[model samples]
Target: MSLLFNSYPLARSALFSLDAETAHELTLSSLQKAYDCRLTRGLMASRPEKPCRLMGLSFRNPIGLAAGLDKNGAHIDALGNLGFGFVEVGTVTPKPQPGNPKPRMFRLPRAEALINRLGFNNKGLDAFIANVRKSEWRNHGGILGLNIGKNAATPIERAVDDYLIGLEGVYPHADYVTVNISSPNTQNLRALQGQEELTGLLAPLQEKRKALADLHGRHVPMVVKIAPDLDIEQIDIIAALLPRYGVDGVIATNTTLSRESVRGLPHAGETGGLSGPPVHALSLRVIERLRGQLGIAFPIIGVGGVVSGKQAQEKTAAGANAIQLYTGLIYRGPALIGECVRALG
Candidate 1:
């Protein structure tokens, strides 16, 4: 094991002592420095290649670092070194905005969960694209997924405009672009998931994507990230529409507003989406239903509550073509990446 992995337990202890968002910012900043100095290279555990194809792109492995960890795409090289098959960044908007007030993020250690209402706080498209262009990983063949969203001030009805701007801005840089209409933090963002609203949103986006493909001479697959709070009926509706709209893939879950699992835990009543072990079964159920509805060929990226190798395998067994991690990284460190990769293999 590398020294960084060996020291994480101690590091986690110290990080856990601080507030959640503070610790998160500190960690990302440190990682940015480590990556810039090349200190993070070769620190991850070695794993044999287990390449897989998804959404017309080849992934080095099926395990990916989920979005929201590096909203600006600033830590791509550093995070890429952590053994993730791919690294997804941003929930960026067309313009920068300060998200919800402080203390918006809460940690539920007992449930191995986190509740966050930090509405798509990011440096916006220009800064985000600049960061992506500066990343060394871009030239080195890292599978990068850029997640885009509407600004908080944008009305729900006009949300498609923001998404179009975001798509145009990051289309050339991303291996795949995730349309993040599922984050609970943004007011009424989930409204876009409705049958009429979803179609209205996806149809034009698909047309624009075709134009972008023609302009760039490369087709970048567009995936939709959905919430885990939906029922089987809703999942089936989404599955049916995806292929109709020419969507390349679907990320089965973002986070959930349901608080059934952590009802009595600290911060359980916080108004935001809950992620981690509490959302695991819900995510699996969505993936299972999506697979059944979309058939075996359509791609599904499963996320929520994957903190161990066992959970990672369970996601694949439940019908995930690929898996992503976020809350798990908060609790397990980078070692979890290799654990999931080896388990998936």
Candidate 2:
């Protein structure tokens, strides 16, 4: 750890002083440089044993770096060096576009959470794939899952086109591909979560998946990223439809629009999705609902508000086969990964 990162207080202070989006960019850039220098490899090499095997993929441990953290594949090796068993990059669109103007991402430090309406901002599919090709982590052999979504301007009826375009772009390089239908910032994006709508969204993607598999000469898993705000009925619909659509797994919950826990906070009024401690309960419920609907045979990647080993264990107990974190890492630092893996053991 940097002398600057020795304490969460200092790291948070250093990072919080900057604009939220800029801070994110600087943090990832710094990590990428550290990885290029091999500064964190030794720590990663000594990680504890707690391998996870789910949905035909092998993870060295259960803790993964969730999507939205490194959206353009800029820090894959750097994050891989942080001891995450897997790292999902992008929510890449067909073309690069400046997402929702300035100040779109806000940090709720007091709540150990964030509210980002970043709207899938990234360098687009082409840049993302190029960055993945240029990354140095291939030899490290950790799982790399690509999270794909449509541009905000893309209509709901045509959403599958964007997904297929993104899926095909990253198929050869990604270990798994996540179809993101849950981001709150994109208008009508979540509507694709409806049972009938989802079938429409998935059918073509499944065909494309087969075509890609044949072209690449290997099978790649496709996972659906869903919202945590859904009711039990909505969750059951997804759980039932995922396997039917030939989807490989589900990312239990994305950031939520609910403000129940952070209601009175200063940043609570910010118009963005809330993530962190407040999201844990809803995220867990979604996993539980999906488990009941789909059974243990289906794979679930539980994410949201995991800042400690106990929370990670609770997610697994709630029906997750593996887990991911973003805001938790902001509050706890890389050391949490070691603690989480040990706790999972």
Candidate 3:
């Protein structure tokens, strides 16, 4: 275990006493301050190099910090320093919006899970882009993914416009851009996952990407993030359409709304996607199924419920080209990064 994480248990206890959102804000703020003071590098152990190639980009390791944790690209440098092979930020929209409301984020500590209905709250594209450009890691060859979503107020039919705006805005600054159509919090967002809706959403983005690639002289891969609540049939439909539409990759899942595993637990009744250990099996099943459908060459970024090295390996073994962490970091701390790297290495 990394010595730097020895104090995590004590810290986790204190943070757990507060509301989930409050604890999250405090943690991010503290991390930002630590990074600003040059204290993070000393406080976290360096991750062992375990290079892997995906989406034609080389990652220092196969583990990445997942989106939603840094919704505005505000802490890329700080998060990058914690030993993630890559760091993804934002579900940023074209305009800034306050998201649901307070008490929107809840925790189920017994299940080592979280439920949130944050609604893609972020600082909009301009601020998100500015923060990305400001990151020291931006010019240092670290992989940074920009996850984009439509505004809450954007009509479901007009959602394509919001996504197109996001793609154009973040393309030059992102190593990859994730079209997040699977988030359960956004009203009618999940509707886009259906075959007809998905085709309408991705077809234009693929066309736009071609133009952007020509303009920038670089093709930034576009990956779609899906929901874990899908059945094998739905997974098959998505897997089949991805190649036809020229989509670059697929992130196996966002979070799930299923409460079967954590039923009767505190906050289980909250209306939001559930993440952490409870979703691990479901995520793995999706990856396994997607891999079967997409074949060996198509990339899949696996994320959900990976809180230890063993779970991380399970994701790769199940067919993830790379994996990401979010809820795990809340429960396990930075040590989880190194543990995963060592396991994958």
Candidate 4:
């Protein structure tokens, strides 16, 4: 733990000092290098023990690298080597498009959070899957999830089509699929959370999921990613809809629109979804609310603002079957993964 903490300040000093996007690029490149090095494979193959099962797939650990960090599936194998139990890639769209713009991603070190209106940017589905297939970077036996979303230009009425496309395309490649309807960017995207609207949108996707299962001869679980801005009734409405739609699980709370914790920080006014410590309490609230509303029958993947083992445990207690972190990964580095796993264990 001390050695892991030692690596933090140096990586933080170097990475955080750069513009947020550049820092992200540097981090990805570093993972690419580490992937090429066989960083943990030799250590693991020499003595294999880590494994976890979730959503019908076997994982190597409970700690997973969340989506948005590897938006294009570029580093699955490389990232897998870094000690994550699982890897989720992309909030991918059907077509490739440039997200908000340059300065779309911002970092608030004081809050340990990120504000990104990155708006589903990626190399599109084809390119993203190409990278994944080319990499052959399976974690020997780790779980992988494909997070799907619609393009900015897609009309809200037809969003289901895009999700179906992603589901069909990534189904053969993923352990499970995440339907991301919660991002605060893109026009009227969050409106899908409304009961009637959510049901309408999910029905077609669920139908498609079944068709894919029939085609592939296996059932693939579909989890819905939700926003944290909902009131209890709203949360209850969606919770009730999950079992009706045959959805597998829910990713409670995406980047928040609230700035309560960092109300006066320099980046406080940034027009994007906020993540990190500032989101901890509210994210946990959503998790607890959803769990309470839906009961223990459904599984929940708790994310947002988790940076320590205690925070992860809090999420687990709040009813998370598994947990993920993005901001903490940036601030605390690789060692944070080890810490969360050990603490959660």
Candidate 5:
């Protein structure tokens, strides 16, 4: 468990002084203005290109911004300025809904972790797509991945309908799409990861993907994002199912539900997925298990708690084809992006 908090200590101190979610909003708003003023590039580290090809798309570097940080695609061009080769935004739902109650996000500074129950709080698909279209990131050769999920009020049984809508809506705009099935904040959402539910979701999802591919004249890949809390048996089941159902890749894994590593730390008992350094080992284990079960050629984007360049290397070593950073970005700032990219290189 390394400290990304080490890189931008003073800035992190200031951001940490506020409530976590407020700091998040303030940071994104600040980034937008900074990018507009053409000052973001000046603050970023040297982003030497480290080209990688995966899921039939080219990435300028393997280090990407993970989904939750830009839940509506509003910060794409600005975050792209942070030296990430790619940026994935939104756990967007078909309709907009206010998420979990206030104070749903908590910080564990000593543990270098965060607990969030921010369910998929995003503007509806229409606004999300409009924001995506407004970005110049893709024109500059940055890869974009659109992450989708069901609305909180959507019944667990009819979840596939929401995902299908999300799939169809995002296909034309995304370089790739991520179907997020593992966020713990949404009630009973993890049930979608079960064998019966997964097949039900994937079959129709891929079927729609084929249809969308024909209409768009481009075969955009569909990636599944799974949780890090899975057991070996669940991993085995997922490995067998992914290729059979035509999933282009799997992001192993999402923020964890376990707080065993930070039991005594502040906010340790908060209700939400815990992300940051404490999750690094869990994420690595999931990646290794997936790689072992899925074989060498199957793509895995390892993410959970990455706080340093060497930790980034550890993910690749554990069988991640690419690595994503979010919680680390919170603690370390943009410098962490270049650090991970160079280490992966």
Candidate 6:
């Protein structure tokens, strides 16, 4: 192991001392600098060879970094070197969004969680694609997934327009495109998960995907990232619709609105989606329910609250074809990726 890998605890201490979003920006900036000088590769721990194929694409390992961590994909190469098999970027919208407001992201250290209402903040699809083109991670055979969402200003009824614009824009560049309708930060965003609303969203997107596939001469997969706060009936509805719309896969969860696990903890009352250890069980339950309904052949990417290798193992055991991390990476650093990969392998 390199010194940086072993010294992450100390580094995290310095980072945690800053404001949550400030710390986020500083970390990515430093990481991007380290990557530019080729310092990240040697600083990383050994990555185990644990290959898996999904969504008609081959992954170098089953451990992937979830979307939120590198929203605009400005640091894909830097993050990919940390030993992830795949790196997903964005919840990028059709247009620029300022997101909710300051103090929108709060740390729940006692609960090993964070609550954020960032509301898909980004420089918009055009800048997002520009950043994506600048990345060289694909030269190393790294898998990249582009996650898309509607702008916060866009009304709920016309949300499909934004998603279609996103899908079409990112289709040719992405290894897979993720339609993210599950984020709790955006007002009325999760309503798209409802039965009639979901049908209205997926039907048109699939039609666009088919046309795009023919236009580009390649069928880029479409995966839906869902929320953890769901009942069995909702899971069934989503599972049934996925096949009906030719959806390629499902990401078992986004964040949660529930604070049942961290009720008394500081920042517990904050109004945003919670993510970390508290969400592990809820995410697992959803994964299990999704597995049961979607069947064994369906692709399910498990995420949320995997703060340990044991949890990563549990995700796969509970029927996840693969696993991802975000909050866990915040607490444990880059080493968490290799640890999860070794456990899964």
What is the model-wide C-alpha lDDT for candidate 1?
A: 0.91
Instruction: Residues 12-60, candidate 2: write the lDDT tens digits.
Output: 6888899888988888877666666655544344345588788797888
Which is superior by lDDT, 1 or 6?
Answer: 6
lDDT of 3 at 69: 95
Error of 6 at 240 (Å): 0.6
Query: lDDT per prediction?
Result: 0.91, 0.87, 0.92, 0.84, 0.89, 0.92
10 residues in a row with least lDDT, candidate 4: 40-49
Of the two candidates 3 and 5, the one with more favorable TM-score, higher being better, is: 3
Off by over 4 Å in 6: none
Cα lDDT tens digits, model 1, 158-182, are 9999999999999999999999989
Residues 90-186 of candidate 4 have per-residue lDDT tens digits of 9899999998878988988888888999899898999988877775545377678889999999999999888889999999888889999999988
Question: Compared with the true structure, what per-residue lDDT tens digits does model 3 show for residues 1-345?
Answer: 546577888899999999899999999898888778755557663655899899999988989999999999998998898888899999999999999988899999899999999999898999999999999785766899999999999999999999999999999999999999999999999999999999999999999999999999998999999999999889999999999999999998899999999999989999988999999999999999999999999999999999999999999999999999999999999888889999987
Clashes in each model (backbone N, CA, C under 3 Å)?
Answer: 0, 0, 1, 2, 0, 0
Tens-digit lDDT track of model 6 for 1-345: 667877889999999999999999999998878777755556663556799999999999999989988888789988888888999999899998889888888999998899999989899999999999998888888999999999988999999999999999999899999999999999999999999999999999999999999999999999999999999899999999999999999998999999999989888999999999999999999999999888899999999999889999999989999999999999998888888988887
Off by over 4 Å in 5: 1-7, 39-46
For residue 120, give model 3's deviation from the true position in Å: 0.7
TM-score of 3: 0.98
lDDT of 5 at 217: 94
Q: Provide the TM-score for each candidate, comma-separated.
A: 0.98, 0.96, 0.98, 0.94, 0.96, 0.98
TM-score of candidate 5 to 2 decimals: 0.96
* Model 2 ranges off by over 4 Å: 1-5, 39-46
Clashes of 4: 2
Alpha-carbon error at 253 in model 1, in Å? 0.7
Candidate 1: minimum summed lDDT over ten consecutive residues — where? 39-48
